[model samples]
Target: MSYAYPRSTGASSLPSYTSVPSSKTTSESWHDLPNVAKQWMVEGAAVFQTARSQDRHDIRRFASLIFRRTFTIPSALILLWLFTLWRGERTVFQESIDACAWENWEKWPQGATPHRVAFIADPQLVDPHTYPGRPWPLSTLTVDYTDQYLRRSFSSIQNALIPDSVLFLGDLFDGGREWATSTTTSPEERYQKYTDSFWKKEYGRFMKIFLDPWMDQNELPIDGRGRRLIASLPGNHDLGFGHGIQEPVRDRFQAYFGQSNRVDVIGNHTFVSLDTVSLSAMDQVDPQTGGTSSVVNEAYPDPIWKQTNDFLNKMTYHRGRAEMGELRMMQNRSEGIQFDYRIVEPADSAIYSNDQDEPVDLPTILLTHVPLFRKPATPCGPLRERYPPSSTTEELEEDEPNSLSISGGYQYQNVLTPKISTEVVTKSGPNVVQVYSGDDHDYCELIHREFNGSPREITVKSLSWAMGVRHPGFLMTSLWNPINPETGESLQQGSSPTIQNHLCILPDQLGIFIHYGCILGLSILVLLLRSSFHVFFASEPALSNQSPVLPLSERRGDSYKHQYQTSGTSSSTLAPNGLASRASITAFPRYPVTKASHDAYRNLDQDDLVTTTSKDKGGYRPARPRGFRQKSVLMGREFVHSVRVVALVVLTVYFFLIWRW
Candidate 1:
């Protein structure tokens, strides 16, 4: 027999068919109703009677089933849509260990051409604060999260089209001092502690996590023979506390990676890696049990404030027509310390045996940790008196004499003067000597004044390390053959003419496009997915109190069947008014279901239901069996609606994986 859902009336809600007064009905005519309709009525009647009986368990089950059929699929579809958008936009970064292959070297420009050198300074590998076994009290300079920044910078450099050699200038470690003792510990223990604690622990772990994989996948090599190769020069910290002394630190460095200072001839170029740190060491003294000290502190007796004042006075007045006399006098008097300015000329007789011992005449390059000059002469004005007299004086006095100013101040005389000798090599023709130094943890390029005349023309370029301050990124240099002047042929060692200044062109468009597109796309995808899920699940109203507002066609057949009961005697057929009423009700207008109406039904109480039915004709209806065919049809519709949602969840997961990669 066909079943129908219960309907609401003005007086009291119509009892379900099951609850209707049952007298033995023998009317064959009533059975003429469609089986689907008959079945619906029976299910609805059962639910209505159970609900009327105040059976909490049955009512709860019916409510839950309806809520699931109504809301679950729609929610799933929304989630799926959000996931798709997320997946489409996400960027997937692939990690590879061996990116640089031997075959990639074939792309390098042919012939022995003077290459551009990029100097990276002051990487400061270990973060002192987190480092194990570090001495108590750390410097104010807190380490930034530089490891990630350097890895990305390296990726950028690798993606760039230019071929280059990298020179790492000094301070490769935060401080060379360590806890391993040679006398008390075994040699292996000492080595293990040194490598594990310093290199493998802090910086090495970072490399393994992010950088090494990048380099391997990109095919960039670190060896000398590899394209875009790298090498290093010792800085003050790299040398530990020893200046001129060949301490254990120096020996350990040599043991690990050959000599600390060496000169390499690449093509027609001479790359001189000087131990600028050693020069500073010559003036340093061991603060703990001070002997004659490793390096002499010439400015020891004189306060730094007074010395800086005198130096500023010389620079301000020596070449200027302007009277900086008042400025110099004010600087001296500003700090009550007496000034004893020593004209600390280079210990030339001691540093170099002969006055005219000229540096090698090849196209030379100098690599050191500190800049040669304190400040380049600026046209706007010399920085000689740039700092207000009081601040400058106080800062200088606070700094140690032999130590190079980590931030603002001047290099010691020893560090400055030796570099001047190196600059002289740049002056000779067809020769361009570029000085590459690190220790500043930033990228900059400066030129020798006499060689190219202007900063733009000068060959010098400075680079910050992959370990220190993170922004602006790491720099790479490429050296290649210069085209011939006369024949337009690249100069060969034997047959071709020498050319000057091989230009470093930036990377091609394809590399840049791929790198940036992936990064931006992935970021957008992640954001969209997160927002969609939040909007749908977090903001939606509850579903239970809401009513299913069906069309008149749906309501009439079910409602009429539920209200009527069969009354009969055997073998007789009779027509009933119920059929006519069902027909008429089916003809009524239909209204669309809304979220607000649905919420109202979901929150309806038994008492509210009684009131609502009396007030609104469409407000109440008998529930159907939890597993009725009508319920099954609703569930099928829900399943169809939820396909989009299921798909979206899958896509979101996929995109999340892509982002991780």
Candidate 2:
């Protein structure tokens, strides 16, 4: 005898299956169904029925089955690894770096290697003390998370690009200048507090975030020498801009991050890092006198402005000396004379070369915190955002105010004054190929018409997500000026180095959060639905009020197996409806059978016996009402589903926390 599923007879509305032909075997009947029907059969029977069920599967059995299936197919493990480890912080950061392709330094002339510098700007690490109105815990979390982000960014840069150097255009701390300036007590005590707070407390955080041990600066080589970390320019946030600058804050920042004004020579190029913030203060009206102080006048003594002016004068002298030395070396090389490689310019030597009345354009890269002066309506390039001009001009007129109005409040200035900017460009030398600055906290690229050569200036975007812009980014630059290996002089005179700049933008963190939030919500909903698949057959409307006929012996035995011994009958014969006399009729376990129903069924007429059961005779029972036990089972199922959903959420959070790790 073969067993097959029965056709649906109108009593069930949940779902119906077509009956398998009784003449065919179970496997043969299933194989005979059309492919399209087969697909519908699996979907309708398995998925729909499971989804429609009101009861849950047994927890232990379900978990065991899943555990076994995992060994055969590791898709669950693979998905977990994909979401957690593969697509994490390193990948996100490296992908952004990759998007901005590096200039092919390998293809350049062999003698002088090109210098690759990664520019990081305006990290402006959040300090909780800066905002008193916010909750302390939230502020702490913001600080921690920002630090982690920077750590990952720095780590990824070290691993992926491995630049010859990393330049930190300032705004290193949000509260660096504010620390000791607050008036709470005597100057001595306040100064001590500032030292303890900044050097002792915040210093650790700064080092941990930006200077991971693995990112040892010396690991990368430039022109056969170790690399350098240039953090010269002090930000307004670090030492306060213009007249608001405090001596103590300036001293501490200089002590830690190096002098605000300095020069670095690498790979036949000059990097002039100027303290424009201090220089802008030179013309402010003196409180002692009604007249403004002049930076050019040697006797006009305002100590802060005086120091920066003296530095500029000294740099101008150095630029003149370097130019004269290089010119003399070039002349000597032509005549085939062995000249001293050590460059020294005597006081009598001419600063100007005989070839041109205009000063020779030097290959220099100027780094500053405040950008050089520009008109308010000047159009920053395509990547510029936040109040961009409606239309753009390719060039700004030279006669227009080469200076922006020196308007500023507490700790910042909009731009350097025209006089200070001119001083910087002149002292920085005639051919400043590029100028990089930060403080606007967004991307801006425009030509400085006042600077010799009208070189491009890029105001790098901030690295912190907390900064107002939607996309935060950094700049990658490659400077290649090939030089003779023996003399260390430029092989091509009168030409500036090949400087290429590319901006690599980071992923939008807000958008990432929204994406993860959607995934979390959808996951919980799917898990809840999956937990409802165990009671479909029992809960069906057709099965609820109807009594299914069962063979007498099997009904009495309450088992799958049976023998024909009904009411002492001896003959074993077919039941005439093509069923074995002793064969069993299937009934759901949910409908219980009792001894009293046997006698009730025996007395009923044949037609009524199978189709209907009298309530008074008690042959067939309706599905039992949901009780305390059934409700408890449902509660347990809900609890398990909740647990699975919570696990997914926790995993997501954990992935973020250990992303860099």
Candidate 3:
């Protein structure tokens, strides 16, 4: 008996082996085989090696093919998703503006004529270093982008609505505050620095971008004859410090925008642009000796008390210089200089006059930065007595009532009451005064009784331009003939004022569309990756058609045989008779059973035979081996196939959702 070991072949080839046995009784002798048998064993071993190498190569190739196919579909889908987002954004933006339709005059209040007015406010051009400059931290709300959107939106409104006039109300620039100069710098240097740095730099940019373009288009006479309809009022920010009360900055503003602060008629409507930056009487007062206490009846008692108390504590006597150029006080009697203009007379007298020597008798529309009479009885007139007398030296030492009753001694007693004695003034038997102001940055309409006993209506409309920081909107108004409510017909007096509040809601629908589209695209990508992972890696049942049965059986049997042959020889030994024997042996007998035997065992009445025989003479019987269980390879294959199917379904759903959105 002999056994032949497998010989090594080339690196790419497998080895061969053979085995033969001489005796059937002893298992050790059976393992020793003839040369032919040994040769066959060697050949079988080589075949197994070759088969295993080929199997590994096939597995690698299969994996590579699967990966390539899986990614191809996803890559194409992603490209399509991105393209959809781009197109969606563009379409939404363009279509949103086009969808808005202008309202017709007839559709408005009956007998009402549509008068479109453009309200522009708070250009708020900021210096990069001094103020919180443009390109604010908020997204899509940066100065450049916001300004561009505004310009386009304005153009749309103009083209679609065709406004009659454009009004610019205040705060065009961040104020000029000198860091190097003390609060007491010369008026000339202060004014010059403000004009050069802040006013010119910040506001200059605004003008070049918006105002200049507007002026160039509309400044020329319309239809070859009509007056240009662009008007501007000075804001405190533009007038530097001291709330536009300074003479130099005030004069400069008047020179640039216009010197006329009174009312003027424009196409049957009067427009009044007022300068509300003049100093109050208390602003010109001194708290110490009371020599310059020009505030006859100090309406603002809080500041008067603070200044009076401070002077008494310091034991200092001082006088205020009334005629001093550019040196004016605030209404609170705080020590500060005026910024822009001087009040040649009191604010009340400067505001109105009915004397033949004064300008009057116009259908007036008053435009001012600050609201008139922020508190009750604070209107320009006799209401001044409701407050205390100007700070006096004796009064400063003691706490006393700052308010006063009507007294004959004070000529300026009624200064805060009224400049005109009536509620309304009439020219040719019709009311001629209407007030228009912008400061609250919101729309309001107020009717108040004037000193002249006539009804005066004031319309306060706000135009906010600080883009996106707050409400970015404007007011659109129309003047229509009053209508009869019952019949819906025009009234005898055909014109009634109507206002429409318009706000820029979204950053041109295009921007919003683009933003959402990006979000949707990212979501799709996440879903696709997740599905691909589960399809390839999840453990599940396999499909029945995955692998051939014969190949799987052969491969599994070969692997087991190779493992046993490699490890079993080391545990075996040969005896003196040239036969292999184990040092210790144990065996357990098992009953040979078939399906027929099992049925007979369960049925007690079934005929059966039982016999006893010598252990050595027992006939060889077929035995069902213990510890052997069938594995469900078919089930595993089906599970894997199911996973792939599920992944495909999920991917389809994801793609459909994206398309719908």
Candidate 4:
């Protein structure tokens, strides 16, 4: 049966990326080799022509080059072999280690459905209260760059990309106490909630300022079928400061935007948007004493993290259980498709069309604002790093895995959760192919590098350049399937979905010219140095007995006869007097006196020049074989040069490959 994809919008004219053709490393073909490489071969051919001359010295010069090449070719081959190996630190995101079949994309079937999703991180929306003469210094906190550039870029992305879904890896609010009045601006007032009028104003302001694309101007859902799917998870900011998750903030967030943690099922796939703050809000172990603690007794604990563990556990089991009917029901509940204002019911006919067959297990892509992998303690975001208590206090807490930071310093580490998320990931088995996270507001893709296997972590750029950080862009992901040509159905059961992550550049406050300019300048310097060295060596004089050129390619046609015979049988042709006759010889020439060839011969001294037309005379004679002693002497010299060639080759390989290995 044929297939249909949801809301596949085609462009009028796709942007052309074909300028100055070059391919990526993983995708390069043999055809991509440059035309300049062929020109180099021809240039080398024009330099060698004197081997066809009557001079036997030129023939020896050509032999010496051959001797050098024995070393040169082997050395180049060793360097080329070394270039194929990646000598960098081990990364689990390598295609060799990834658990999914995405590396084998070519083997998959064609015409599969492509699902596009855009990931944004840490808008950190700062909407200060406009109360008249507020006691607090809210007006002093002026960050104009975040206000101007970030909001404009998000609007640009929404209009330009028009993705199927937008996962806001949240830290959406700067200080999320909009409802609190001016009178109660103290630290204690952080937990206090205002009247209903305050919440209405807060929601309205947020929609207009930050999230206009997801809804209409009238504060209603847009009925453009398969329109923008909005999913957001709480960052530490969404809760109050010092891991403060107030009841009012949590309740209002759910009332407006569905849930803090949500599962979205689009077609056959499932995407989980998790509240990382809720999961990691409570520290299970005490820093002072090496013992387990409850949320109430813990130094930093709350109701958010306590319920988050239980909520995630139930949800994990609800989806993973093998029973088909209940599993389908769980997926349908999270289905993002809509007929009108509300989500389609579980009994909807359209939902059952493709899912008519017994429900089979599929991949689950997980997203968390706080990464499972702990990041470096170096500060990059707007959240300034003060002295953290656990980091400074030299306490009796026991050492843990590599995930938890045990360093006694000023920087604090985000400790491990109750292992609920890990358990869910482990129980999901092969279905969990990839995990993405954000809170750091810096781009980092890490892998667990487990003995069995692990998925990749793709952390994205923040929307704002708050702390003058480097990266500021959202991730665009394309999820597609391998469609079987014969059956026309996607090969989703055994295969993994193809995910392509693209980092779309937003405006950077600091330009990239300096970074790229240095690289370009270095490349030019290297090229100039190489060319200068080549010319320097080529202009130098040849060795005392060597020829200026060698006719390396035309060796078979040309013949050389030495004027003085060294062989025993050729002694009759030698001068009777024992004075060595001037080494006069006839040559069967390969290089005639053409303009190009004449210039090469013009460099020779008058004594070295040939007066007679050797080609017209046709007086070519082969020299007789030398005596055993003479032959042995020639063999000894050849053997010595060969040994030198082998020595150079060994040295070259040792320097290039052995050191790296």
Q: Ten consecutive residues with minimal summed lDDT in candidate 2?
A: 539-548
Q: Write the per-residue lDDT of candidate 2 for residues 18-54, one digit (tens) a residue.
A: 4444565765766665665665564567666675552
Error of 3 at 340 (Å): 36
RMSD in Å for candidate 2, one decimal?
14.6
**Clashes per candidate (backbone, < 3 Å):** 47, 0, 65, 5
Measured by TM-score, how close is model 3 to the native structure? 0.42
Writing each residue's lDDT as its tens digit, candidate 4 over 339-405 gives 3566545666343223233324445677776666433332222221222223334432322221224
Off by over 4 Å in 4: 1-112, 127-145, 177-202, 214-225, 241-243, 285-302, 316-359, 374-421, 427-430, 482-497, 510-661
lDDT of 3 by residue, 1-661 (tens): 8665654332222232333333555545434446556456567776787899899999999998787767654445455545554444334434433443435222564334444455565545434322333355643344544455456545554554455666766655444322112223324453333334444454455656566546545533221213344445655455542221444555555555664243343323445454443322233334343544333335534332232223222211111121111011112232343334756445433422222222222233445554444223222221122233345434232222322222212111211223211211222113334545444443433345542323343323232234222324454444332333233233435334333433222233344546556755664555445443432343332212111112211122222211111122224344676443443121223221223333323332212222222234222211211211111222233334434544465456545543433
Residue 340 in candidate 2, Cα distance off native in Å: 22
Pick by TM-score: 1 or 2, better one: 2
lDDT (10s digit) by residue, model 1, range 1-661: 7544454321133333323334436234335556555555655766677777777877888999788766643454445445443433221111111222223332454434334444344555545423545454532122332443334334544454323455566666654434233532222343334533454355354345334634554443332333434434555555543322235555565555455555554433445555555444333344443743332257553321222223222321221211122223323432222345555445422321223222333444555565554333211111111122233333332223322332422222313443333332332223444555555443333344644522221212222222322123333344444433222233446533232332122222233336446643554455444333332233222211222233222232232322221123212122363232222222211222334333433433333322112123322333222223433343333333334445466556755643443
Off by over 4 Å in 2: 1-64, 67-90, 101-112, 129-132, 181-195, 213-218, 287-291, 295-302, 320-361, 385-407, 484-489, 493-497, 528-640, 644-660
For each candidate, give its TM-score against the true structure. Answer: 0.42, 0.65, 0.42, 0.45
lDDT against the true structure, each candidate:
0.39, 0.63, 0.39, 0.47
Candidate 4 weakest lDDT stretch, 10 residues = 539-548
**For this target, which candidate reaches the highest TM-score against the unseen true structure?**
2
